[model samples]
Target: MSNPASATGTAAKAGLTMGALGVVFGDIGTSPLYALRECLQALPADERSASILGALSLVFWALLFEVTFKYLGFVMRADNRGEGGIFALLALSHGEHQRPRKGGSWLIILILFGAALLYGDGVITPAISVLGAAEGLESFNPNLAQYVPLIACVILGGLFLVQYKGTKAIGRIFGPAMVVWFLVLGSLGLWHIVETPAVLAAVNPVHGFRLLAEHPTNAAAILGAVVLVITGAEALYADMGHFGRKYIARAWYFGAFPGLVLNYFGQGAWALSHPGDPTSPFFALVPEGPARLVLTGLSIVAAIIASQAMISGTFSLTRQAIQLGYFPRLQVNYTNPDQSGQIYLPLVNGALALGSIWTVITFKSSNNLAAAYGIAVTGTMVVTTIAFYSVMRRRWRWPLLGAAALAAVFLLFDGALFYSNLHKLVHGGWFPVLVALGMLAIMHTWKKGKEEIFRRIYANEITEDELCNVAASDRIVRVRGTAVFMAGLARGTPLVLLHHVKANKVLHETVVLLSVVTEEVPAVPDAERVEVREIGQGLGVWRVVARYGYMESPDVTALMERVRDTGVPVKLTETTYYFNREMIITGGDTRLWHWQKRLYSLLSRNARPVRDYYRLPPMQIIEVGLPIQL
Candidate 1:
């Protein structure tokens, strides 16, 4: 008899793989709508057959090597506690050191830029995917082409509007919807392939090589267009922490990969048979009837699903950035109580919606937006490879020669792809670059300002002995109940506590210095969450350090319960919480430029209040304003 446990395992894996299809593969899976069309459009029309076969061959190997071998076979192994992303890779490469090693600053800068580039990708993916799908209406009725952008914008708006409902509710239908979407993709492609078996020969690498060898001038352009096929590859790795490597790989191999391959080949075959046809190969694959309209509707739904994945990924990335101190703290809502990863950021959602809609209106068509898409994806890939190399050498302790050889091979592909897209800078590629640079400046400024504040706060240290003496002093009156002071540093007494005592000349009978620390990992176990220590004998003063993963949001109320469990008298409702409210003043001497100082100050002012962010009892909280110069 088969083991019941084994059957259960298979069932759970199957469920996760189905979920991965909806969320992880949506971006790449939807590429067949536009990738092949754009690739063929970029090549010389004189040699149509050679170009079609070459483009198909190139796309096949690109997905196999880059998405399959590079990400799944290798990069996924570098996950930090089962979390994978540029940030996770950065943490792994840095190892146990809290600070970057010598010459590691460049790696940090590179990774930050890559993370910022993802915001650009987040904006473009939705615009292009929705527009690509909406363009299908043109094949049904030529006059509908003029209204494509409007239809796309409406779909994007509706998608963003429903984001407040959270991913769990929205995700229920994603798996089933994408399953149907991929099935249609495979069916259409297979139908065409049966009619023209000759297109299967495009699977050979020789055709891809011959295209480049024969057409030297258009080589870079050809590669640039071809990069579209693998634009969603990074999403596979970035979303790995959500579903895991095994399930995501299962989704790709069994569901997404075969469908994508067959569909792409079918598009190529259809293109060969109908030369000089101006209609979209994707929409043209189906007969001109209600069946085509159904396909179009399905494409729009798939595009929405693709956009949802990117939006969700952006929320996760923002949370990670804030926890890691690279960005200002924003209000994050946990949509699902069971899943910490399901989050909604109102500000981030609004910004992305606006950016995506603007892109749709500006580009006007999927083909136009395609010009702006590849650079951000390729730039991020290069950064990931470089960061992965550092992880191999430093964290995994691989031999230098082995790591270098492997990274060089990956770089040869990534670097070529990035270089090929460089000329696109003039052709709307500047959009993502501009967006990335703006984000980089904001992130760099926030981080620098925080470091400056950290250094300034610790410059005049208050030791435990000093705090104890103040507590025991005859001039200071000891009041009833508990006082919890929020601390920026794990070891130092919060400046707010010192200010409160100095201003009022009184102390609470029970004092708790609570510092919430975000570790580089994804999630910390409850048992290892909090560390508590008594400050002095019989003084009723304690130091508590609560550890959390970058993927987690700290709940002060929940933390207090853990503190009470530690035998410290921490009442959830009765305790009064104190927080430092910094009044930032610009124009002081600092490493940051004049403009950055102003921007940092602005971001600081707009950041969610500490009590609000932590969801503390607002009525019992007190804010002590402390003015600081940048």
Candidate 2:
């Protein structure tokens, strides 16, 4: 008889594996729409057959080494309490309690740059995926060629438009649809492979080596295009937390890997047979009939699904960044209550929509967009490799020799791909670099600006003892009801609290100094969520620190209830919240450039109010304006 607990766990793992196929593999699964075509286009006209085989061999080996071996084998193990991504990796490597040792700051910059590249990936993935899929219309009816961009733009717009509604309803279908998608991919490739059995010879590494040895100049360009095959590899690592490492690995081994290899080989086989027609080898595999139309429809569906995955990923990444203090707080709306991971960020969604549409218009076709794709993906791959090596040494405590040996192998592949993609810098590759640089600047400025502001504010901060002395003396009067002062510093009395007593001439009989800290992990246990203590000076003063994980929404009202439940009985209606409203006066002594000062001021003014984010009652909230120059 099957044990009930074991059966339940088995069912849960199976479900997660299926879900992973839909979200994690979407980008790579849809790559066949253009990756093979782009690779073949970069090759010389003379050695068509050998080139196709060589490219196929490269694609196979890339997946084997990069995605299968490096990410699935090594990177996934460095999870931060079941969460994975570059930021999670950064947090793990730095150690939650310890200050980063020696050159850790530089490591952080590398991780930030890597994360910035994903935004480029986010913008370009939809444009290229949808356009590549839409371009297949030409195979069915040549008249549809002119409408590809328009069709792709509309599909992309629709994809972004529906993001707010959340994917929960249709998310169930995504797993099954992707399952069917992979099966069809495998079946199509198997059919073609049976017909052209000779194409199997491409599996040999010698073919790939020979092509490079024969044409070193063209090889780099071909390598640039070949990187497309591994474009979505990072997503595999990024999305691991949504599905556990075991489940994602199960999905990759059982589903995505087989489908991708078979389909790629089948496309290569078809390319070899029809060397004259350099049109999309993916679509050409199907006869120009209803079957072709069906394939095109499937490709578009797969592309839209892939686009949705990236858009959702951007939302998650932005939320993490905001929690980590790298970005300004934007409105993060959770769409599904049952699933904590399901979130919608309006500003991120809007920006991504505009960027994707602009890309579709600027490139005009997937073929043109292909040049812009690999740079961001390869750059991110290199950064991921470096960060992973750091994690292996610092977090995992692997020996120096072992870590260095592994790093050498991973960097060898990552470095080659990165250099190959660099040739594209002049040809549309600058788009991602520009995007990454701009993002990096904003992130660094925001972080530095916040730090400088904090430094300035805390320079003359009053101590808890000083506040108690004031409370004890006749200098300040003690009023009736409870007052909560929101504080940034963990130890010092908040400026707003001190100013309130000075200006208002009185303070509530009960004063609570509340501070919420965002931790490095995804979720903090409720047992460790709130820490309360009495800072006694006979003023009924309490120092409260509420800790939240990066993934949590801080609910101060709920925290108040918890405080009340723990013997500090207080009525909600009697409590008043005090907050500091900072007005930045720039152009003083600042490390930031003049324009950055202006930008930081702009961001600070427009940031969401602390009271609102903490969900405090608006009517009961009092704001104290504090002017500071930086």
Candidate 3:
């Protein structure tokens, strides 16, 4: 079942689709600014005709095979708590409890790796989107080259600047802007197609196939060409929970799909008509003078919207990643309760802003920055293919061979795109690979460290029965209210409890051992997740967990009310919450590369204040600092 708490029935169904349109479609929507033009930039005259057709064919096939078959058909079903993202889907497909019990499994390892790659994605999205949009400045005046970086910086800064205000304020503008983007793409491209009817040949698969066969080198470039069109493909599936699977499906079929096809074909027609020109056909599509200026203004707005979609996607993805334990927890704020779509993440916003500005300055033009654009998009797509197969076999219970067949078609296309982007690696693509690698390192290291800490502190050897004996014998007076103890593991004694008993030697009469478990699915039902039981005596263990949709948060107060009927009696005067505070040490027996442990420790201390995030009362909370040797 989808996440039970947030979007439900009609709201989820409609929200999912619209959310996808605003977020998922951003990368692909803005591709018209350069996808066709870039393909032509790399193709020679004899192969140009065939290249155009072949590129279009590859783009079409990539969308249908990789996007439609792999994601739309399969991975969307692998939602975690009703939320969809690479990490969330990975957590869903990977068995959390079972793997932890098994200890050191590849399933767990790869899941962490996939999550790290998303950070890579977070950095790359803004870089390319803003860079691509800023490159349009060349259309007005090639001399604008020196100023492109400045313009890109300004636009990116503005994007990050408005994050605190939340998307609802700006989101209204996104839909309308994208609508304008589509109209501009369609009308402008149609004008060129009207002039050169022969351009229609590119729509045929044979032309695309022939072009690739004729010039293997040029065909290799089609991988990058397809990259342009499918750049935003991940957003489609990542945002599945936001819009629901159906809404994204419709927006693609209706709004985004038609506009992209018409415009790309239109670019082909223009190229065919003006074979001698080296400048981009997209600029040529606009009527010169004030009209061109107006179109440019509109394109700029569309670019911002595209960036916004990706930016919001980053925040949403980070939330899922944090909730799923791929990254250290950061502060997550909800701007709109009714529209679960509105969220603000301060760290993520700041990071994206800095990265985007650095990219714009370093490349100085979209053409140069465009060189680095495709790898992460296509890499994530390839990773999704593998994850998609897992979903098919494990989640969907699809037969192995059928899943393989479908995945093969999709991965081959995705592989082509990835290989295609390799050509740009030196040009600018190295940046994303660097970003992805750095992110992967940080994620793996932190997970390794945390897990090591979990292993060390949790001597599962000490049974709860033993703790119960110790707790009962201790001469601690019974408090009228319940004191909640949040534990990392269910049955194993929490280090906090042991440490508290050792240091304080007192137990609350109503000692509730609470643990919050986030399942793989996007949403968990209250009946299934929230449980309160009597573990006996003044020491009753309350296993309380609040499930977050890909959109919701892990708020403690909200959950307390949800599970009130559970055996743990609640009284504000009697209730006191406890969370463990970790103190880091440099030297320890850890599998982590030393640097990662250091980074993880630094990150943990600074993450969002847990008490405030959960909306727990200040006086009613206790944090115990448990020191660990890394």
Which digits, one per residue and each the tens of the lDDT, describe model 3 over residues 1-630? 333245568765555555456667877888878777777876777656545666666666666665677677777767664567776656555444434322256665665555556566666666666666666667677888678778878878888898888888787666656766787788777787788877776666776677677778676665676677777777877776655676778778777777777788788787776777777777777755777667677777777877788778778777766665656777777887776556888888898788777877787766676677887777777777787677667767788899899888777777877887888888878887887777666666666777888888875546767876776674754546677777876666677777777777777766767676665556665467576665645655545544554445666776776656564577656688887888898788778767877888887788776687667888899899888888
Q: On residues 444-535, what C-alpha lDDT tens digit does candidate 2 reach at each position?
A: 77888888888888998888888888778786788888999999878889999988888888978888899988888877888999888888
Alpha-carbon runs more than 4 Å astray in model 3: 1-19, 45-51, 68-70, 73-83, 95-104, 460-462, 538-551, 562-567
Among all windows of 10 consecutive residues in model 1, the one with the lowest summed lDDT is 1-10
> Candidate 1: misplaced stretches above 4 Å?
1-8, 96-104
Flag the better candidate by lDDT, 1 or 3: 1
Tell me how candidate 3 scores on lDDT.
0.71
- Cα deviation of 46, candidate 2, in Å: 1.3
lDDT of 3 at 533: 60
Better-scoring candidate (lDDT), 2 or 3: 2
Q: How many residue pairs clash in each candidate at the backbone level?
A: 0, 0, 20
lDDT of 1 by residue, 474-580 (tens): 99999888999999998767899999998999998889999999888888888899999999899889999999899889998988898898899766667999999
Candidate 1 Cα RMSD (Å): 2.5
